[model samples]
Target: MDSFVYSVNATVPIFLVMILGGVIKKLNIIDDNFVNKANKYVFIVALPAMLFKDIAQSNVKKDFDISFVLFCMIVTTICFVAIWLLSELFMKDDTMKGSFIQGSFRSSAAILGLAFVQNMYSNTGMAPLMIVAAVPLYNIYSVIVLTFKAKKRNEDGSLIEVSNAENIKKACINIIKNPIIIAIFFGLWFSVLNIKFPVIIDKTITSVASTATPIALIVIGAGFEGRKAIKKIKPTIIGSVIKLILQAGIFLPIAIWMGFRNQELVSILIMLASPSTVSCYIMAKSMNNDEVLASSIIVLTTLFSSVTLTVWIFVLRMGGFI
Candidate 1:
């Protein structure tokens, strides 16, 4: 019961905010153009700022658990590789391959994951460490998958697929220039060097970080397309299942068996079940993948994660794992 209420308190407000965005859009309080610009702003400025602030502020050195971090890295890599290979073998639509793979494995570690932990525990606990371990790999793997599966239109309007070697090279370049990745790097450096910011600069970062999640959620709600989601329903459902269920089902038990509990276990649960990140849609659009599919996955996962995550938390609490 406590777990259920905790889950509701953590997820319901976010769900309501998204619903508010959808309501505003339906009433024509905002239009698609505004949503489009909002997404751009989130991808370019808001998300980066939020990540920088979180990583920079985290006491990573004090809380650094090499074993936990290594486990996260291993699981994230396996998921990314396994999903991409599965998509290659099974997904018929080339256009959806990248988005499908991305939406499947990328967890919302930075935003909703942290929010869930903070709400439930009144502190971030190990969530920031979890982000440090997994989020960079998420961005790196996303770049590779999106780049390799990218297709462009020829003069005659036929699609041209990128070669593997060129895709790898381009992905390497993108990993360097990606704003989120760059921000993560700088944040890690600051944490490592124990850099302190001036009060005004810190306040500026805090203000910018504050805008990241809400604006992204609103934009996601405004741009959501139900009909398009239906068109891509198969992959969308598969990806959601992977994100909200299978990953957790597979990994959470291992975490428990390995003796992680309390805050560490709860953080692992968030890493597994907190829905697909909005960044998936952003990167899919930028990389010329199926943005509709990406957006649909985000919407569906966000809507469903409330229940799924609640169940996980309840089960974990019952079993004395958290």
Candidate 2:
């Protein structure tokens, strides 16, 4: 119980940041145009720098928990499939279907994954390896989803075209161009060859990289608007169920199979089950797919994570992960 209170208290700062974003949007103090600038600041500089710093400074996960990695792959595969099937009922329009499905299956790695890991583990033993292991998985998953949902033109001259293979191709190209994935590749190469960062370079990188979450969180806050979510209620509800329920349900058993238990496994599992990334709303919108629905789902799922995160933490502490 005390743990729950403390954990929830830690989450308050994140919510406050989100509220600040909402307030900014409401006040129109931060023009919509600036949001793009903020994106550039966070994505191109702060985020990539942070990844480089973390990778350079940290000891690599020499032997990734293959089981954990496997779980991540399998569960995400299942999520994409599940969302595709679900889209048939509620989102037959190919463009909307692609974005909606990807949104359902994807997650906000920055906010939920990195921030939550930093908070839960603090100076714990497992965090470094978890971060490294999670990096490739998250990066790959994100690119794949985004590519699949990218704009396509149908034969009938409709603005949206949907093809599983097309999305896969886009994802492959995206992964190649992605800075994070590139960083991960470098990190992995350095790890395999046993490289270490020089003290000065490490310090410099760490200083720049450290800005990622704090600044990104603020930007997320600065961009959020409740108005964007009005018509997206249905997809939001549908996505919440898939994310908080189905994804978690499958992941728990996989954690047990991986031989992790208690708090550690709980942390990983809850993260796996977290709501899809808030960034997806923005990305889907940028690609001109069901932006309203995507944004709504992000808002709703983020709200529900308050409940799901607490429950998962309790269960993990109780040793239910195994």
RMSD of every candidate to native, in Å, equals: 1.7, 3.7
User: Which residue ranges in model 1 land beyond 4 Å of their true spot?
Assistant: 26-28
Question: For each predicted model, how many residue pairs clash, with residues at least 3 apart or on different chains?
Answer: 0, 6
TM-score of predicted model 1? 0.94
lDDT of 1 by residue, 275-313 (tens): 899899888877888888998888888878878988888
**Residue 278 lDDT in candidate 2:** 53
Candidate 2, residues 255-313, lDDT tens digits: the string is 67768764357446545666666556545554556655665666566666777777877
Looking at model 1, residue 63 earns an lDDT score of 85
In terms of lDDT, the poorest run of 10 residues in model 2 is 123-132
- Could you tell me the lDDT of residue 144 within candidate 1? 84
lDDT of 1 at 267: 85
Give all candidates' CA lDDT scores.
0.87, 0.63
C-alpha lDDT (0 to 100) for residue 173 of candidate 2: 79
